[model samples]
Target: MPDPAYRPAAPGDGRRCPRCGHRVSRYNDARHCSPCAQALRREADSCPRVHESTWAEPEVQSAIAARDFGALCRLVRGHAQLRQEDLAELSGLSQAFLSMLEQGNRRLTNIDKIIDLVNGLGVPAQLAARMFGRPG
Candidate 1:
């Protein structure tokens, strides 16, 4: 008898998604494949949503007032419960670009991209005006 904890590896174990019944070449941690998971993420992220609270914390307000772009990005994302990937999806920016901004590797000077970020993240109009000198 096969030992309960010593199940043998099947020929295609961990390489097929049970939900979609699609065979993949590599093993994935989730039952769904990469494309399936990304599709689901897109569907979920497509919903029009915004953070309901204002950036009122003293530290966050200080960061905004200082115009510390990296700190502001971190504060906004953390307060809104958004991951960098989610922010990228919402802001029409690449994860790499956002990471660069957060890491201070890239300067945040482009008004157009900043507007996109402000709109996508649903930043308060007054706060956006203060930060960017324009209400986006």
Candidate 2:
């Protein structure tokens, strides 16, 4: 018996995935099989490190220098290519709170919360020191 998950390709209907030798539905633009695509997504999601160059960007530096937590959070989210949900998961902040903060509807004034955000996002220690007005 054939695999239930496997769909035999009809002409122009599907193609074999290059990565897994499995049928890729025509509707799936990525071309990888579902399992392969899911695995790729998992791998990408597993690493959320912000690139070193992201810290050097003028906007990021400005946000840090200004101590604008909201703007800094937004910049980090963008630079790290993370959704608010992902960032919330990492920072232990609620998604709604992060959205509000990003929109300037809320402020992150509490020192502990600031530390949590900095630590959760893995902001470089030197930069965190600068942000906190401590000599790095």
lDDT of 2 by residue, 1-136 (tens): 3334555567776588878897777666565778997898898879666667778878888788778878988998898788888888878889999999999999998898888888888778878788989432
On the 0 to 100 scale, the lDDT of residue 11 in model 1 is 73
Taking the tens digit of each residue's C-alpha lDDT, what string does model 1 give over 39-116? 877988776454666477666666666667677777778877778888787888888888888898987778788788
Per-residue lDDT, model 2, residue 129, is: 80
lDDT (0-100) at residue 7 of candidate 2?
54
lDDT of each: 0.70, 0.80
**lDDT of the structure predicted as candidate 2:** 0.80
Number of the top-ranking candidate, with TM-score as the measure: 2
Supply candidate 1's per-residue lDDT for 106: 84
TM-score of each: 0.57, 0.62
Q: List where candidate 1 sits over 4 angstroms from the true fold.
A: 1-50, 134-136
